[model samples]
Target chain A: MAVCCPLLQHEGERGEEARRFSLVLRAADELCPWVEPVALGSCTLPARGPSRFFGGEARLVDQLGAAVIGALDGAGPVQIGAADGLFAALLAARAGVIVPPGGSATFLSSWSLAVLRRPDLAVTLQRLGIHTLGQFAALPARHVLARFGGEAVLCHRVARAEVGELPGLRDPRIGHRLREVRGELPDVTPQAGFFGGTSAGDLRAAGAVARLQARLGPEAVLTGRLGEGRDPADRGRLVPWGSRPEGRHPGRAACRAPAPWPGRLPPPSPMVVLGDPLAAELVDRAGRPVRVGATGLLSDAPARLSIAGGPWRQVRGWAGPWPASERWWSGRRRRARLQVVDGGGEAVLLAAERGRWWLEGRYD
Target chain B: MFVSTDQGGRAKPDLPAELAARARPVSTAASRLLPLPDALAALFPDGALRRGSTTLVAGSPGGGTTTLALALLSTVSAAGGWCAAVGVADPGVVAAVELGLDLRRVVFVPRPAGAWADATGELLGAVEAVVVRPPGAARPVAARRLAARARERRTALVVLVDHAGGWPFGPDVSLTVRDAEWEGVGEGHGHLQGRLAAVAAAARHPAASPAVHRLWLPSSDGSVAASPVCPASPTRSATTAPATTA
Candidate 1:
């Protein structure tokens, strides 16, 4: 018969707790420099080589427990169990009991079949009055295979204390000695103040943002790229960092200097584009409001426009009312955009929609 | 302004008289001058971009502002130092190749909007040089604050101020492309081959006198080289022939 040693009372999952527990496991590696440790919190280690090295299975478990406790500053309730298979070893560790070699089957014979954690098999066995692993294992192997498949047969072997396939260890060097300590990590965010400062604080801030991204997803931390489009609002595309841009390859498309558009506002685009156009008043010579006709023509010659504040300035060099209409099927609306250079040499882009004039953006 | 007679692109051993006067022990984090390519040396006071200071490059769309920015970034990145660019709407990859910038060492954040300051500050903390543009019309106070942060981190900040409005706040040094004339393109005679531009630079204190140079903003060879000044013109001119390094 082979041996399996299982640990109990694993650490919690918070970052600090996980780090502290990793430290304890690392220390375990130092003590049993050859046994590979498998994880569940309380780690499970194969006891063959380590047992031989430490005189016997009993001494090996005792030594590992002592070493782990010592490394943890004597944190108590370090349970270690050694048995023939993983299932029995885990149960034994939980109960702080060890089954002697060749007596694992006898020890497991009285435990409930539910100990295997196979709910369906346990329920079926219960319905059939087979309440314990001993009773379940006592059934004909052929009959168990025919009914529950190879998985059930493997369970049957584990219940009988016969060594089955082992799980891949989480840490390959679980029982291997750690050669050196990784140098102390610098403070994630150095206390560089708001302007320019230490990188530690910036690094820490980036780390925090990464954590938040992990929780909330990549969409929350957006990195935008300028794309080719006529409307200022549609010109920029916000995408998660590292993701490929949607639609056309906007990057290469806009590489060369674009052809000058007659109606487009020239270079020095607005610093900020208003999400929603603000209502304004466009007036004619007589102080009456200027209106647009249904045919996309101005009701009167537009002479002046006012936005946000100040006295209305006379429009000097004026451009077209490039009319645009969208969502015709849902709820059609028409908007006309005009580029107006005021008498003060200042320029602004204004849009008129639904018989109302609004300031779209500034050319400053 | 002092002038250099070395016309060829080859590196000159002797420093220009003007730069030699301005060359003093710079208080740098590495305690050494941050090197600039020899071609652009005429544009700076000490023949190097001083660390922990801000340099503003402003020009119209066709005025070679991007070329200048990539040129500055290339110098630092080629020397095995990391550099970053924020709010440069154009992808620097295509232009970096033309400017001889090492793409592998340079990091480009194409469009940093509202978080421009934060992003630039972070890059200043880590990279040797950072090139950025104001996401919006940055107030003078905000611009000064960003410049102060760069000083603290010992990282050089290069701002690509728009040619139309220029820099929101005064920079330690400013380079403006006064005018650019395209070459080879005649009515319908030839393709838009390259450009020649007059660049003017002025530094704060001591070097307040503006220095002007006419050069190939991007010569036909896709490299920025010093062009000789027109002999008939009174303005300071480099050699009419492109400066050849070979």
Candidate 2:
């Protein structure tokens, strides 16, 4: 069971709002340890153990309400609701009612189906002549699963007050927002993975990642993935690490050698794939510029190369002008890729498009 | 040379520490060392990545340092150890797979900017290994702090630098990729098939001298393993970078 404190009038001045929120939280903390500040003007906490300590759920709610009202001192109306779950408790607080234990379903029986907050489902249920939550709850669970699918089954559970929490009911960033309101630096963290237990290394790594995210903004920490693409840059993707569930390991899928694709550069993938390819110049032995024609053939063998107009180096070994006309559907330009190794043993992959070459990556 | 120091304080004062270090069996030292692949073991004094030790990988741009550093994390990650990389900008995911890094075990803060030290410090004890490339020259204090934290945490730290002097703190093992030569390609013919990298190691041990090794950064099979010198190869130190394989 959970209890909710919904402040009807705590949002005028910035300082005053912070003051009221903290005071409400302080008062709530005196009664229980797991006080969660859900938003600027609302909070929730577990009621089972605290209810037992205060003799019953009603006494805890009354004591909590009195303490909160005392802290506010006629600042506004304080509606405290105690019920089986977050959804029921939030609505109960809005209605200013203390629903008796296991009577949440009975209390919610009178509410309109719109209170479920799934407007589409509400419209569909209403079309089926189910207007109130009680009417929706009376539908067979198996039939709900069959006709409405898993999400509607969840709504059906919430309609019965069986499960108090729904995925979209609570704001995910409430904690970060509240911290910012308190003039504290906020650390954003995603919800824990479905796995219930974690090892000590996981705990430490999660803490470090969260700290880095807070310090360096969210996008700095990243994990790499090589999806299906012919271009090396197209294949290598970096996603903001720790911003999603990590139970899906990145190993099994990434470790397998890339499945052969037509026009894919052969093995020994480049180590340095430039995010923005640098302009390069390739020329033949006669000091004539080399170009890849529409036939996907080089006009002349590249004998010298210069990247970004740097000093020209003797191309000791070279291969390929493999056609990779990727953007042709939108812009009718032809593109081809070439591999070159200089006398210094530096190997580079270059893409020739629009009669010019660009340094794509380095096989360092 | 991370022998089980259960024999540390005990009466081995006259037993010459070098002898003991060399004689210690692989089994006992393993608890303190992350296992190294057989191909790379010959380059390290302990034949493993020592716990709480800093290893420096220095080379010119495109001189195979990235491949070496990523290669170090492969076995450790395959063994289910967590590893982190900081300041390795624009890492190639396909290449990382080619280098055998289990992407799941590796975390990258590719560009930490001014907070690189803090990020590396925070991850030292947390992950089994941390490979970092400084965005700029590292300060003495920052370098010392990271090295000290790594030493105390039993974490393997691999620092990538463009030059030998780039890292201010002393390192346990310093591997510099002197040069590399691409193989299996001709003048405008075949594609890239392999690369032979010339690597040199300078460790802190008093008796060990700096040694140069020739190995394939990515061999014909697309894996890093030791190389046998090609008999007819010519050394090319005349133009672009440093001295090449003789």
Candidate 3:
């Protein structure tokens, strides 16, 4: 048996329109687990079980039409057909009729050679005045093979209602493609109870992240979290994804709740905060090194900034010197921050500690 | 002062609502396109990120490339779409949060080391979107294979580059932040506030002309919003931003 959902168009309908087509497959799948997607719009399965359960093929087709039409959302009419094989069933589907049991040969007899989809063979047969399957069937099997070659033998069998389907009729990639679009790509689909309520998107993400972690050490793949802190770096931490809070002392591996922290940089944190601060130099216009003194003030008005002894970039604007002190319980230490916009229109956060400066973040 | 003007396309802020909307696995794939925040929507020909397409967000080292790339992923993540960031090294989580991403839906392969391509390839079919930043100029053959794989899987692949040329192949959509103006900070007064980035978009469609628009990449409150100001010229000559008082 086969049903063609109107939603599947051959014009690359694999995108948005493909969803409804998948729905038709789902409805069919509910009736039987072995539903196979034959092509863009049509699918097939063993008709015996579903037909028997519904009392007869006609009754099953009626219920299947209702279910598939609902899935289509009125997109188009659903075509249902059942016969001995895929070839006859698809032809029966087009005619929107059920072939009686043992009636596939009678049903397929009147159809033209075009249904075989072999244009060259169909053209040759048409020129020979054997226009319909019945006429082609009337020819002797040995003569058909001797004249038309190997493929004609298969077509002759199909015309005689022997084979279930043609080679190109069923797209073997349909199931694989549908599962991929649903983010159900793992060879062995992990059961749902294992992950409560996470979307297929999330499951897909988890699978990919796991693969990357396996390839590049567990610590490489991470998830970001924000917590209470005074600077961008302290506020945002990337913990190895899936790390247990108990493994790193409860409440630390995961981000803590946001709390008021004094001297914190205000709204709009830097986009890229460096893990390893790059050494930088700042100087006054008179060619003198600029410093942040003990009073949390600049020793001189800075005019130029150079990163790691690179070419000097004229400073266009500046802000900060927000002093934050810590470790007073052990030993007192102080650090100050500054935001500067260079002449090239790039903004960077520069931090000074112990009279040394380094690039801390970039507002990219 | 930058005021946020919400776009019709911004995703729901609540995770529960997004989860509820996720029950229909088929509906998401129906669009063949991923949603983008309104501010960046006009950049693409379809006003959405087409699945299987590659978009390159390019700019200088400090020219808002990171911010724009994150902004591109924020709406999708907020909508409960799974997103992966490869080669970001150290991402500012607060910045990502403030930019509108639902952190729970985003995974970061901050350091892919030598297997960046492999990591990205593994993620293409599994996630709705994957953001990759190659450590250096990517090789043509490797880039070609990745692009082909992305197309085959129908995943939206966003490549972040220091400059457009860093990617060996031309992308389906190419967006570059030409320049930006800081609105709040002065020589020594106020604080670091919003930035109005002058961005240019050129999609591969032959019928559509390239476009330029100014956006508050990190508007006053940290979310990306549209700027009321006119776009700057393509010659990169003008900086027409008037610092609006917040």
Best by DockQ: 2
TM-score, candidate number 2:
0.68
Docking class of 2: acceptable
> Per-residue lDDT tens digits of candidate 1, residues B14-55?
557754433322212445457776778778887787778889
DockQ (Cα-based) for each candidate: 0.06, 0.39, 0.30
Show model 2 residue runs off by greater than 4 Å.
A1-199, A245-251, A255-257, A285-289, A327-334, B1-30, B230-246
Tens-place lDDT per residue, model 1, A1-364, is 1112223223222222233344567667776654434543546666777778889877877777777676555444467777766666766776677777777788888999877767887888899899998998798888889988987898888777775333342445322211111112111112222212323333433343343334443343333344444555555333443233243443343234444443443333432345466778877778888776777766766678787765788865455566666545776777777655555544456788888888866432
> Candidate 2 lDDT, tens digit per residue, B3-108?
3445334333343675444324222435788877667877788888898999999998787888888888877766556688899988877788777776665788
Q: Can you write out model 3's per-residue Cα lDDT over A1-364, one digit (the tens) per residue?
A: 8898754755242143444576788888887779888777888888898889999888888888888888888788888888888899988899988888789888889998999999999999999888999888778889999999989988898888777667787777677656643334422232221123434666667677666755786578776766556867778877666542123333233334457688888768888888889999999889898898878889888899999889999998888788887665765677899999899888899999888888988888
The numbered model that scores best in TM-score is 2
Mind giving the per-residue lDDT tens digits that candidate 3 earns over B1-246? 443355545333334665555433323457788888777888889988888999999988777888889888877776657788999877878888878776666888888888999999999998888999998999999899999999999889999998899999989999989767776667676676778787889988898799888888787667788776656442321233333323
Please provide, for model 2 over A1-364, each residue's C-alpha lDDT reduced to its tens digit, 9 standing for 90 to 100.
3334344233442234544566677788998889887656778888788888999878888888888887776777777777778888878888877777799998888899888778999899899999999988999999999998999999899889889887776667556545433323211122111121233455566667666766785578777766776899877777666332223544444555677778888778898888889999999999999998877788988889999989999988788888886766887856789998887878899999888899989987
Residue A194 of model 3: what lDDT? 18
lDDT of 2 at A350: 94
Q: Pick the winner on DockQ between candidates 1 and 2.
A: 2
TM-scores for chain B, in order?
Answer: 0.79, 0.80, 0.84
Ranking by TM-score: 2, 3, 1
What is candidate 3's CA lDDT for residue B232?
A: 43
lDDT of 1: 0.59
Docking class of 1: incorrect
Return the TM-score for each candidate structure.
0.43, 0.68, 0.61
